[model samples]
Target: MISKSKVTAKLSVIDRFLPLWIFVAMGLGVALGRVYPAIGPALDAVKVGGVSLPIAIGLFWMMYPVLAKVRYGKLQSVSANGKLFGASLAFNWILGPILMFALAWLLLPDQPHYRTGLILIGLARCIAMVLIWNMLAKGSGEVAALLVALNSVFQILCYSVMGWFFITVVPTWLGAESTEFHVSMWEIAKSVLLFLGLPLVAGALTRVGFVRSRGEEWYEKKFLPKVGPAALLGLLYTIVLMFAMQGDKIVSLPFDVLRIALPLVLYFGIMFTSAFLLSKKLGFSYQETASLSFTAAGNNFELAIAVAIGLFGISSGEALAGVVGPLIEVPALLALVYLSLWLKDRLFPADVRANETAEPKDQATSLAQGGQLR
Candidate 1:
């Protein structure tokens, strides 16, 4: 078992490097986009049986570490915390979808594909990235792990249902064509599996391997640290490829990016505020509150992008909207991370000071607690 102190300590180091690494990745992505346009298409290829595998492999690699850390038992933990679970579920499913639909309808009236893209973005919930955010906020890793698992299950079921409703029922009710519903649903599911399922399986397997071989301690101390940088790098690499693939589209509609970004920004701001306020009202500790807040705020862009590409084509405005999500999100999350640290100082001043004072004592406590951390 991992101890909380060790978890916190590891996260502190991760918090320091995550931003710089992500920035480097973003820069590299821009360069890659400019230098290798042809390679971008090649990377997008998907293979099931001896064919070209999808470029979503990058997403898979990125999320594997975090998934591996999740314990199955933690799913029960999330269930037990019904209030938090319900709040998160309502935001991700009910409020998120409604807001996204409205935003897409309002912002991209001329671009139906882009509208669907926005809907996809809102429907997908955070899995891996939320883990990082939760950690930064000093939330319980166990709870974070639980939420990741629950969200993954929810996304798989709800994405298809909500997506179908969006493309079919909603559109038809509004006098739009529903002819594309079947085709769109098929494409969406395929994209979800390629982007989400594959990564989840790979990540879970990797987690099992690390736990078995490294004995959790080594896994925590060594393996997990490596994940933060890798994830940042992966994001950068993917974004660059996305830019290369969509540069012309983006250049053609420069103003559209801002339009696309609006709902996402609103969604983040609203969700974060709601989570923090609700968590506080529930009397959650700072760590738990921050975790709840961020988990609700973050979007799962990989799934959204894949679905956007499948539904609307790689060069479509929908895909472009999906790409912009992370461009806005990465910086926003970094800011949140800093804010979490600052909040720790203000709201939990004594705890923060005690944490500082007890830094050395943490290791001693870990030893005394028989090396159990979580």
Candidate 2:
């Protein structure tokens, strides 16, 4: 088995530079689109239900590695940290959505498409990347694993339904006439079925098949590394195609991207701070708080981008807003990871009776055992 130090070292390079890589890919995509105009659209024509087929393939790759790591069967572990679980659920589902909706409405009143994009992003919480962020912050891997598993399941269940309501029904209720463009509930369901359903099933099968056959250790440390940066690879591929189709907009109104990013930045910062404070108030341990904070803060940009393109077309403002989510989120999350660590030292000192034992319990110890301070 690999040591924790080795795992950290291995992941550091990719995690640290993810934002830089995304921006580089974005620029490359814009450049290619501007330079080779015909190639971008020809690829766009290869679509089934508004999403570019090429982009969908990349989206699958982006989503698959994330889904593969989730252990939906481990939900029994959830009762071990009911407080942690409840706080996370309340923040992610209740407060997070309302906050982002307010931000989108207050900030982008004039840009209805951008408002819709941000709302979609808000409805879809982070299922995959928060695991990495939680690990980087020295949070409990077990708690992080549980949070991610819960989020993944919740995402599949609620994303399409909440999405249909918010993206379609809620907007009209709020008196946003721009939704008159007419997106059917069937269309939204189809998009969800394609974007999230396929990768989710594929990842589940791969996880069960590999673990039952090769044992969990080899399936995780060995097989997982072999699929390094699957998220980034898929992200870069889709970014290239997305920008390829939207080159003209990038060239003409570069600042518009910044407008889309504004609400996202606010969303991340607000969620992180609110969750952090709530964790502290609830007397959670440093690591537990870190996991909770990151869970509440991070996003599932892969699903957002895929659904954006599928629902709004590859070149729509919605897709661009979805793309900018990661551009801002990567650096924002990296910075927050550091902040969480620093806070562990100062804001919430490690004085738990459990840790004073000088003999740490197993990583997966339940909260009832006083393990890792749920």
lDDT, candidate 1, 233-274, per-residue tens: 455555555555555555557688888877778778777877
**CA lDDT, candidate 2, residue 61:** 78
The total of clashing pairs for model 2 equals 0
Q: Against the unseen true structure, what C-alpha lDDT does each candidate score?
A: 0.65, 0.71
Poorly placed runs, candidate 2 (over 4 Å): 1-19, 47-50, 66-74, 127-212, 216-221, 228-247, 285-291, 299-323, 344-374
The list of candidate 1 runs beyond 4 A from truth reads 1-17, 47-55, 70-75, 171-179, 183-219, 222-229, 348-358, 361-374
Give the clash total for candidate 1.
Answer: 7
Cα miss at 226, model 1 (Å)?
5.6
TM-score of every candidate: 0.77, 0.70
Instruction: Give the per-residue lDDT digits (tens) of candidate 2, residues 314-341.
Output: 6788877886777678668877876776
The residue pairs found clashing in candidate 2 are: none
